[model samples]
Target: MKTLRHITLVVRDYDEALAFYVGKLGFDLVEDSAQPEQDKRWVTIRPPGAGPQATTILLARAATPEQSARVGDQTGGRVAFFLSTDDFDRDHAHFTAAGVTWVRPPVDQPYGRVAVFADLYGNLWDLIGPVPGGACVG
Candidate 1:
């Protein structure tokens, strides 16, 4: 079976994105190596506690005007990502304390508790937590 490996996320600057994702969101920096041929860094990050084969985000610096324009609105003003956490309260508190911008407060859904928040670049994300005795909300 095939598995999705990496999702490229366009950003204005790599370091700034790293600062928000790693410093604030507590994601793990899987790699940061120089790709001299292209004058770019091959940077990858993943959520904490993710498995080795889990999908990782590739922080890609915008190299063109068109790509730059899409830096924040990757999904055209809609939510761009969904982050799943086992502990909703813990992660929600951590994100709030880290100064993450909350778009909507946590609310209980039929499947789980979910909240919307924006990333450093204004990309919307849903922070989801599993319901009791159930998996994460779809």
Candidate 2:
């Protein structure tokens, strides 16, 4: 079986990224190890409750101008991430309370409820929840 395991995000600072993702977004820190061979750290995070069966966010700290330029425009200023939650209202409230910056208000679509928000580094993301009686939809 094949699986897509990780999605990489170019970050400016490791600690800041960790605080945003783990502290604010509530992701779980799965790994944090030193890679002395490359002067880098191996860090990975996943959504809460995902455990070992979810795709991870691999935080790659930019080390060059080219990578730094892509930090917040990974998808050319379009939405670069999608964060789906089981409980729309709860997560929405939590995110709002945490001061997450929303670009659009929540709306109910045929597939689900969605809202656009910008992450700490200004990368756009869709915060989504499943339809009331429907399956998960992106």
Candidate 3:
């Protein structure tokens, strides 16, 4: 079966995105390899404590104006990313202390407890934790 390895996210600076993901969000930096020939680096991160093969996000630095424009809102002003956690309250408290901008308070959905928050560049994301005996999307 085919499996996803990484999803590329356009970022203004690789290091800034790294700090946000690895510092505030507590994701693990999986790969940081220099591509000297191409003048770029391959920077990838995974969810904290998630072993290899979990969905990894590649923080791709924007090399062009068009790419830079997509840095925050990559899905045309919609929340295109969903980050699921096993322990919602712990992460929610952590993110609150970290000063993450939220779109709304957490609410109980049929599938999970979820809240919307913005990335540093205003990209929306859903931080979700699945409810026991419930299903989830993405």
Candidate 4:
């Protein structure tokens, strides 16, 4: 079966992105290797406890003005990412204490408990988790 791999995320800088994703969000840095020929680095990160085959994020440094302009609004004012968690309260509290900005309070959706938060670059993400008596337990 074919599986998705990495999703490219444009960032102003690699280190800063790592600081936010790894340092704050607690993602695992999968790779960070310099590609001197291209003057770029291959950086990838994934959520904590993700399996080896799970999809990861490729932090690509913005190389042009146009790309930089879209750093945060890749989705045009829409939620750009979904961060699923097994424990909603745990992650919500951890992210809040870690200074993550919440754009929407947690709400019990039909599928799960969800909250909207902005990433370091202002990209919106839905922090979703299974809720008791909800249908998203799987």
Candidate 5:
């Protein structure tokens, strides 16, 4: 069976994307400046206390028009990074205070309370907190 390694997101600017992911969202800078010849910086980020082996989201640089267009179009859709949180309300408040643009306020779903927000590169993210009495089965 094929195993999932990472999810790559093509962004127009690296600095802007890095700022949003690292500065605002609190994702640590795992790998930066891996390949200089390819102009590729393999950045991997995850939530705090998340294990090292946790799946990583890569903020990739858009080198072609087609790539840029694809990422841009995906921004407004359902594609999002699902984040885990213990307190949805606190996370929502933090995002609001950080001046992050929220697509929707926090709402309780069957599985969890989720709040959708946009990154600096317009990528959508679903910040989720599991609901009480809602069992999560791996």
Candidate 6:
């Protein structure tokens, strides 16, 4: 069976994307490489303490005009990314103060307290905290 690995989001500008992911959202930068010879630049970020096996997301933009149009539309369209957090309230407050827009405030659900927010590029994200009896151990 094939397993899912990394996911990359094409952005219009790398620096802006980096600022949103790192400066605002607090994801740690794992790699940043620009290979002109290869006509490609690579960059990735993840939450702190995420191990090597943790999925890494790449911040990239389309290279060609056709690709740019597609990515631009994708950015404005609805897309969701879920992230787990121990302190949902604190993080939600922090992000709110940082000018991040939230579609909904943190709400208590059966699974957890979930709060949704939009990234700089308009991508949606669900910041979740697990409820007490929500553990699954088989």
RMSD per candidate (Å) reads 1.3, 1.2, 1.6, 1.2, 2.3, 3.0
Model 3: per-residue lDDT, tens digit, 1-138?
999978988889888898898999888999999999988999999888788779899889999988987888799999878998887778889999998998989988988989999988888999998666676544
Error of 1 at 34 (Å): 0.4
In model 4, which regions exceed 4 Å deviation? Answer: 135-138
Q: Give the TM-score of candidate 1.
A: 0.95
Q: For model 5, name the residue pairs that clash.
A: none
Candidate 2 ranges with C-alpha deviation above 4 Å: 133-135
- Residue 32, candidate 5: C-alpha displacement in angstroms: 0.5
lDDT of 4 by residue, 1-138 (tens): 898999999999999999999999999999999999999999999999998998999999999999999999999999999989998989999999999999999999888999999999999999999887665532
- Residue pairs in collision within model 2: none
TM-score-best of 1 and 2: 1
Q: Which candidate, 5 or 6, would have the higher TM-score against the true structure? A: 5
Which candidate should be chosen as best, given TM-score against the real structure? 4
- Per-residue alpha-carbon lDDT of candidate 1 for residues 1-138, written as tens digits (9 for 90 to 100): 999999999999999999999999999999999999999999999999997898999999999999999999999989999999999889999999999999999988887899999999999999999866767864
Q: Candidates ranked by lDDT, best first? A: 1, 4, 2, 3, 6, 5
True lDDT of residue 88, candidate 3: 78
Arranged by TM-score, best first: 4, 1, 2, 3, 5, 6
Weakest lDDT window of 10 consecutive positions for candidate 1:
129-138
Model 2 error, position 124 (Å): 0.9
Q: What TM-score fits each model?
A: 0.95, 0.95, 0.93, 0.96, 0.85, 0.83
Model 3 earns a TM-score of 0.93
